[model samples]
Target: MKGLYCRADAADAQPKFVIQETSLPEVLGSHQVRVQVKACGLSPLDFKVPKSVVDGCYQFKLSDKKIENRIAYWCEYKYEWLSVCLYVRPKPEKLSSVCVAAALRDALCAYTALHTHARMAVGHTLLVMDGASSFGLMCIQLASYHGVRVLTTSHSLQKHTFLEQLRPSVARVIQVYNGSSDLLPIVLEETGGLGVDIIIDSGVRLQEEEELKETKCLPHKHELISALGVGGHWVTSHQDLQLDPPDCRLLHLKSASVSFLNPETWTASSAQQGRYLHILKDILEKMAAGVLRPQPEDAVSLYEATVAMETVQHNQRKKAVVQL
Candidate 1:
């Protein structure tokens, strides 16, 4: 089958992704499912090959589980179908395939970060950093739907305005300038000096030497700790994050907990696969009920996926889906 392939001369060398003919194993694993391509979500994950490619909307062609003809979530492809090792859930009838493809993974990440890791509850105040991001947008919407008050940060006036104009309307949209320390103060003011009940950041700056860059909008670790209310939870996506003794002491004093948001655990560990499928089902149901909305996306044709992928790879676009 023809698909997007990552070519590398050495294991340590950088992967060069190209659209070309590739082949899948004729044999399927015991737990594997073969998914016929419908559409593929463009993500950084797509730029690097994995043991399995599991984010896209597709139809089940063959599986021991007998889910054939069911439109489901997650898999990658080009001109032809590809195989996915993960399980499947029926796609929502109310939404198109591309729409479902764009929303599923981000919704999963948001749900895992807020509900799973942070244990978000109604009436709690949430500070979502970078509200313009697709994942951040999902976090805001899901929290808003659950009656949680949301305060989000934006780096530009346009993004700030967009966050303010959301249908449910964010409680506060704070514009953050580079090298500015205004976020903590604004968050404190909004919460009447108690800080927010939950803090979700895309990443956090852990060192003093780190430059204030506009690309990532990483909140300083100290600020995040200070911004958390007593007994609050901080959900972070930073994988290589490190904490110093002072960082630990501050968190301990406030009884705040930090949990890394790793969605791969669902597929990596065998015990979590059942729960993963359940989450997918819940996400689709929420989408069907209009409780969760898909993020804004730019759709591209299958042939255009080769170039469109770079946009997602370099973080130029958050939600780009390849329609087959």
Candidate 2:
């Protein structure tokens, strides 16, 4: 199998990727299937992080000659034959394969975070940080579909404007400019000082309260807790996030709860596997019905995957997919 391999070097911070040949697995689990790669999705998590992961969706052919279309996440390779667990679900015939590859996981993340973790309902107020990204956009659309009022934040004014004009309309689009303190204030103001019912954040500032003029500067933990209304749900992707005593006190005061949005848990635990496949099916059906749509794909060949991955890490593209 030929794959885009990432070799980490201690001398440099960035990992270098190259196409390399690796041996296929000799054995497969009873429930596992070997899939031929069709397209692989690239996001900040795949590129910015040092780990090598092919976050992909594909059309497959098993040993028994049975056919399936699957969206998979596996480490250490970009594309090739993959032995994936039963995370398989039927891809909607109406949706393009590249679209599924580019958006499936992110859409699943949004769905699980909002519906499962947050318990989002119609008329609920939602605050989605990093609202311009594919995941963010999906969160907005899904929430809006259920009649929730959405207040989203974008890194730039241009994206903020675009989000404001979205159909069904966004409640507000707050622009965070180079560490500007805009999110909390705007969220509070729009919600009439009550704050939002749900907050979905990609990442948060762990230690530093000091502002940095970086483009992708994350919100401070303090700000996140402060913007939660009473009994609010705060869903975060910040796995390493730590909360201070003050942060805890604020959440306590508001009777707010927090949940980590780790989609991989479904695959890691046996009990949730059935639910995982069900959700995958629902997401595909929604896309077919026009209730859900993926982010625009910047398609690249296998040869150009390395450069495309770099571009994703730098936030130069919304979403990138390796099309085979």
Candidate 3:
């Protein structure tokens, strides 16, 4: 029944012991199952929780006694009648950590693009910016799995070659320097000047004083904005992009839509949570049956208990369990 707890020190500080061993609370009704967590993945946000809570900057707090044993996962109940549960495989201690992080990144990108940004119709084209990251590459694979044509970009020629091997569904791959504005013309030409159906901006944008310099030097932002067709969508995970409006007025001019994913708002709804669990069950069952092969035998691990948190910060990912 031992569980993980965030320490109030460095971002990557390891989990510490809670005052009490973690355990499932008594089941309130038939709708719930005490899931034993098999594996939980660490996210960037997971590393940030310690500082926020310890600094007294965090808005949410539980009695030292309550959170001493529990931290809330994304699943939660809205109305008293509803509840949610998610099942995930744990990462193994020895495998490449990037692979598991990539899996979650794929899940997030796939879910976000499929459900949030552009509806994935059978033949639609998806343009993924920064296509080399685990999230971007996974987005390409998932979009292709659903029959969407994917166009992705990478600054690394070598990485582009690697991605091409990974995603046969990618219709085209473009190589450019980071923040290169010159590539926009090439992108527009390749797409027949009509523009792409969707643009995913996953690259890092310069900020503060550096950002001002980038504005003068980089044309990727401008080119990206220009390349969206009317009614097409642009999506980004950039925090500054989320907080402030894009510099260009083209979205308003072209009636295009822009969306920012604040992973903080990523909690599943009651019904959606049910669906998520069902999907995970199917994934696990497939792996068990050897129908859907796992990347490797030691790809992930499973955990035994749940931890509760009052309010997790905006962008970190943490590992936890669903005790069944």
C-alpha lDDT score of every prediction, in listed order = 0.77, 0.76, 0.51
Candidate 1 residues lying further than 4 Å off, grouped into runs, are 22-34, 46-71, 74-84
- Please, what are the lDDT tens digits per residue for candidate 3 over residues 114-133? 55667667866678876766
Model 1 gets an lDDT of 0.77
Error of 3 at 272 (Å): 4.6
Candidate RMSDs in Å, in order, are 5.1, 5.2, 9.5
TM-score of each: 0.84, 0.81, 0.60
Segments of candidate 2 deviating more than 4 angstroms: 7-16, 22-34, 43-63, 68-86, 178-180, 207-209, 215-217, 310-319
* C-alpha positional error of residue 251 in candidate 2 after TM-score superposition, expressed in Å: 0.8
Candidate 2 lDDT over residue span 23-99, tens digit each: 86667766455677788887654323322222343323445334566555442222233323444467777777799
Give me the displacement of residue 220 in model 2, in angstroms. 2.3
Q: Candidate 2 at residue 301, lDDT? A: 95
Q: Would you give me the overall lDDT of model 2?
A: 0.76
List, in order, the clash count of every candidate structure. 2, 0, 30
lDDT of 1 by residue, 1-324 (tens): 778764555556655668887777787877565677777777775323344433433233454454543555544332233434445678767788888878888999999998889989888999999988888888998999889999999877788778878846598888775556689899999999998989999788877567755434677888899999999999988777898899899999999999988675565445566777888888889999988887667679877887787666666666588888
